[model samples]
Target chain A: MEELLANPYVGPLVLTVAIILVFPLIVGYMVLAERKVLADLQVRLGPMRVGPYGVLQPLADALKLLLKEDIIPARADKWIFWLAPVLSVFTGLTALAVLPLSDRLYVADVNIGILFILAMSSIGALGLILGGWSANSKYSLMGSLRAAAQMVSYEVPLGFATVTAIMCAGTLSMQGVIDSQFERGVWGAFDNYGLMLIPTVLFIIAGTAETNRAPFDLPEAESELVAGFHTEYSGFRWSLFFLAEYAAIVVISALCVTLFFGGWLRPFPNVELLEIPFNTVFPAGLCLLIAFGCLKGVGKQVVPGFRFLMAAIAAAFLGAAGLFVLPLTNELVIGLFWFAFKLGVMVYLFIWYRGTFPRFRYDQLMDVGWKWLIPISMAGLVLNGAVQLLARG
Target chain B: MLIDQVLFYVLAVLILGSAVMTITRRNVVYSAVWLISTLVGVAGIFLLQGAEFLAGVQVIVYIGGIMVLFLFVIMLVPLEEEASQRRFSNQKWLALATGLAVLAMLAVIVVRGIGSLDHPGPAPPPGPASLTQNSEAVGRVLFTEYLLPFELASILLLVAIIGAIVMSKARRRQTES
Candidate 1:
């Protein structure tokens, strides 16, 4: 197993499959989760008819989108019109490649992971610009222009916020940042420098703007621009736009997890209890460890079948361990519990933003991005740098 | 070694293709985009060469700042069909000849350079020493060894900014008059 992990091709290949398969699934369900939450908030039931309590709503939506007719406007440039959604979806997915979900999980943990993510995000804006321009509609054109300006403005602060993490962690690798947070003894805003209260708040705000979530979702303000850059798109093509937006939300959320939330890290780093007795006596500890290794291996295969098998196996093991293994694997159980809890909180906040806030006016979006978020994030970066220097001194 | 090969091929294709597209594209906006691709490719080349600070500066200065200015200009320019056509004169033959000559020279230099190289040169020592040493050395040399040239570059940038402002103001006055 160690030998397999040590294999150069095997590690990266597995990471790539895990990223591609898992991220979109998370995004798809997140869409359903948001709908349900919003529906409940507005005193309505959301997709109750779809598989038991709407568990299958996302799948149903996916099938509906797949069967929908793809449309192209009469005046649109056919080539660019086709290319735009592809670009948007491609760039949106590209971010997942650099994001680290766990210590050993990332498609490609580049030395310049943050910069690569930022660059890929800017490419998504290019798709919006092209989509709007090719449509040849006034509303679409205005939406695209506003989106481009908004993204460009917010990107500055987003970059600054990212630089704060990079400076504090002293590494550009997403995994490294998470490891730093874990090594510091806590997760999220509770980590180093006596808690990252200010910086994390700044990062969350900047991240919201960067992903164009509500209160900053000027690009797709339905009341103003009638669906913004995709005003002329319909059916599967329109669904592609929604896919890109939701995927962006997931990517940014994962980034927030990595940068500030100690991604996939259990809450307390010093709490590992070595079970020498269980390993020698019951041997389930060793088997559980082997199961984990297998999950990592199978997860890398990038096939849906393997991924489902891996998840099911993990769940089965946890369920079967109720009698003898529960006492032995308490720390491991707790660790997994904390990890899931953290991810759930982050996911809830993403949906909460969608449900609560109204979309920003285009000018307000630009102003907050340029005037407030950017400066505050820059100040955070400076403060973080100074803190690091002082700590070293 | 595999990463190096991939980076080399990707950067080479990006730089060459985008450079060609920059001139070949008739639309001013497309040309600006091609220019951005060219600049981004150069940044990638810097990364391939293990120059991280240089790569960051390349993106920040060229892509983030300068390209925005270029895009603003392109957007403001009224590139009507007649104006676009008038901008290009009947100098295709001359341009092609010049381009071919430059390409031939570049090919010869590259071929000669490859032929002169030793296979699998000694690997440098790894870790932060190798990574930071070069950048720190360059910084020292830049600040002290080549301070005059560095100062001159800043002065040149200042002059360009002032000249741009003057040109725009003059144009505005002329339009008003």
Candidate 2:
């Protein structure tokens, strides 16, 4: 048992398990962050009553969702309805298996990592369509139809954009793409005197659509479809859909950071002058700053138990921060720290988008995807290919 | 090795069972769902064979794109009308006999082929590294050896797209004139 425990693979296996376990919790807190950020944007206090500026809101929400009665409508296709959310959650979580979080972190190091990701995410679309159809409601059907149309249309541009990056990197492996970027001393977006800029922009726009976030969220537009595909889903089942959506958002943002922002790489990673400070001070300072913010929130908290919980979280962050100050942990945390930092920015962009943009009309959404994004991305891909060819010549 | 054998058998059974279920399902939607499961089973088999890229493409294109299109068409069909249609009342004994004969022929082929397939005389067992390198190796051959076929296939697809647009536009022009 001890020998088995000491095995090198055991460490990564355990960590991967921990990541899977922790994913839902992180997703739950992301909901909290979105609520807080959106509220700030709209000039509201948000869930102020839920333990120190709504810090405990996600936990509360989870408890409520778990306790609430799950309903399957009398007319609903029970098997497919039950299967839909399972499909959603399954695809969402499985895509995480191939994601290279840091150098040492990842569940599997698949050669066709991006292809695997694309496959899983595309399958996720089936969940939404099936859920909507199984509901047997007109609104649900319409919403799902819109979603299916949107996803299928947007995927073209998204593929083109990804292909553009694959061309730049000359490898399909997620880590290889990152390593290529590091070796070239430029992110995929800034390659060839900003030639890849168009595709990067195209990817973000299409990725936003692909995730069904706002501006592209015609499927679930409350004004039209009355909550869209999952309209008939209730309680725990509904929360499964919510969890899947947020997890998918995380997957997309993580991919974005890996592809465009440089996976696990700090600013100017190759620069000898900036390397030492960035490697040490940046991670330590960032973690400490996050810890400080959490600690600051504890002061404004109301309930004693909530405050205590917040304090514990703060301490954990502080401990992580403290680890970074030392040489051993500094090396360990830098990869993760930079990766998380970039991913956090991408996630923030998602919330900021939701707050600012109005939902696109169905036709308009289709027009943008088909007529505009697709052509632009295809042109960008061709142009980049030409540039690379010319440069080589 | 034992686990791999077990998994292969399980997926084989699933593929066959799902194929039967897909055709037998009274509801079109259920049939489509089963068809998807069958496709997924095939993808699983591909994965087991270490054709990981092929597996991904199977899911992406067949299950994702084509299956979605199938579902769309199925959804447009009037369910009430479809539900009332006689499902298995054709009573075509010749059709059933032909199907059985085909199955028998396939069984015979498989039984005959299985003995010869075990030994690829000179080639060693392709391991995990070969599995990971599957796509790159395939791409290399495809671009070099089958370059003509590959380019021709793409040109054909491009022509089809242009033909579709031209046909649509011609109809619109006639309507306007």
Candidate 3:
């Protein structure tokens, strides 16, 4: 089993399946998370009846969507119409190929991982463009056009910001960038300056715009375009579009964790304490001990002969001792915990933004992408170059 | 030997099929998509030739950027179904004959070129860095040795931008006037 897990193809295939199965669940709960956060901010009670603190809301929403009737507009271009949502979902999934959730966990560690991500994301705008155009509705067409223009404009600044990070790290590989941060014991964006300063702030702003989050979601301004490009879509198709949107938010969050935060790197500088687990095979021993304890307990319950109950009690005590020794295990488990914590912070920020900000107007959105973001990203690139040069000198 | 031949034939068929579709498709948008497929096939050929950077750039610049602009233009055009179907009758046969003759001539030239390269020569040096470094290397070289040409390209882009704005704005003025 250990050898199987270590196989290259097996790991990616397993991770892919896991991501596919887990993402919808995450998205469902994220909806609840969003509502709860928003309700807290607005001083109102969120959903409570369905499940404890509205835990079952996402499942109910999924059921509703599953039961809804699918609709296709009469005048829609049928071929492109079918292709658009598929393309959106496919592009979102492809971006996951490079995302590293933990130190040794990733789908493919391509040398040009960053470029691969950018290229895949470039295809996503096509989904919006085709969705609107194929619908043959004036409103849908306008919304899609706005989406295309907004994405194109924002992508430049986003790419520039990414280039700034890449230049500073001197590598296009995501793992390489993360490892650089780990080596320094500081997040890449905060290595020189303090937190909430220049380039990091620029990255966050650009990332938000790139993902079409609040204050930048001009494409789907509900009041104006009636849910924008996917307005004509219904049921499963519309759900797919929502899935793509949420997935995109998740991708950007993961990227922020990998690029700006020390991905899977423990916050503390010294890792000597963390490495203590490597000295002993505690987990393996614990697993064997637990199995023996389980068998003894079962034997005690089924057969009341030879004082089995007392022997089982002793076995349980030994298993509990093994459990207590888990902290003395390896850096691998600690690294996984640190990675999850960083990703959680990034995910929390996405929810925070959704709850706090209002959507931007079309003109204001364009102005931010062009006037503000582009200039800042360009300046950030220059700053990164200067820093690198000075460091070398 | 059979596998190699099959691979070559398959790529050739795809290249030809997409090129034909690009020209023959009545819908401008569909034609643009067909053109993208043709570009993708060309990138595949580049990959076969060990020109990974060239293949990537072909996809990025032609398929991703330029074809996107083509799609935009096609979408912007107020082309009706009847107007799209109307063919120019003035030089239809003449144009077809000329096109076929040119194709035949190019095929002959290509065959002759291939025949002359029967003997394999020394291989080219390994590529400088991986495919990922292509853009960075090109940027460095262009900004240093080819600085003048790089500046010229920028100027050309500027002019095109100005020209596009002028053309679009001129139409508005004409409508108003």
Cα displacement (angstroms), candidate 3, residue B44, comes to 5.3
Scoring only the A-chain of each prediction against the true A-chain gives TM-scores of: 0.80, 0.95, 0.83
- Give every collision pair in model 3: A277-A329, A277-A330
Question: All candidates' TM-scores?
Answer: 0.76, 0.93, 0.79
Candidate 3, superposed: residue stretches over 4 Å from native? A1-7, A192-197, A268-330, B1-15, B39-64, B79-151, B165-177
Judged by lDDT against the true structure, how good is candidate 2? 0.86
Considering the two chains of model 1, state its CAPRI-style docking category.
incorrect
Give lDDT tens digits, candidate 2, residues A151-264.
889889989999898888888788888999999998888987799999889989999999999988888989988999999988998998998898789888888788888988
Considering TM-score, where higher is better, how would the candidates rank from best to worst? 2, 3, 1
**What lDDT tens digits, residue by residue, belong to model 1 across residues B1-177?**
776788899889999999999978777766767887898899888876777667756766576555654554454455566345755568978988998999999999999889657675656444321223444456679999899999999999999999999999999999999
User: Could you tell me which residue pairs clash in candidate 2?
Assistant: none
Residue range A222-312, candidate 1, lDDT tens digits: 8888988899998788877777887777777777777777776654554665333432223455456645765665546455655676666
lDDT of 3 by residue, A155-186 (tens): 77777777777776767677888887777666
CAPRI quality of model 3: incorrect
lDDT of each: 0.70, 0.86, 0.72
The worst-scoring run of ten residues by lDDT in candidate 1 chain A lies at A274-283
Candidate 3 structure quality by residue, lDDT tens digits, B1-177: 364457667777999999999778777766766776688688778655545556656765675566656666666776576355665577999999999999999999998899768886655344222334544665678789999988999999999999999999999999999
lDDT for position A256 in model 2: 79
- Model 2 chain A, poorest ten-residue lDDT window? A7-16
- Rank candidates by DockQ, best first: 2, 3, 1
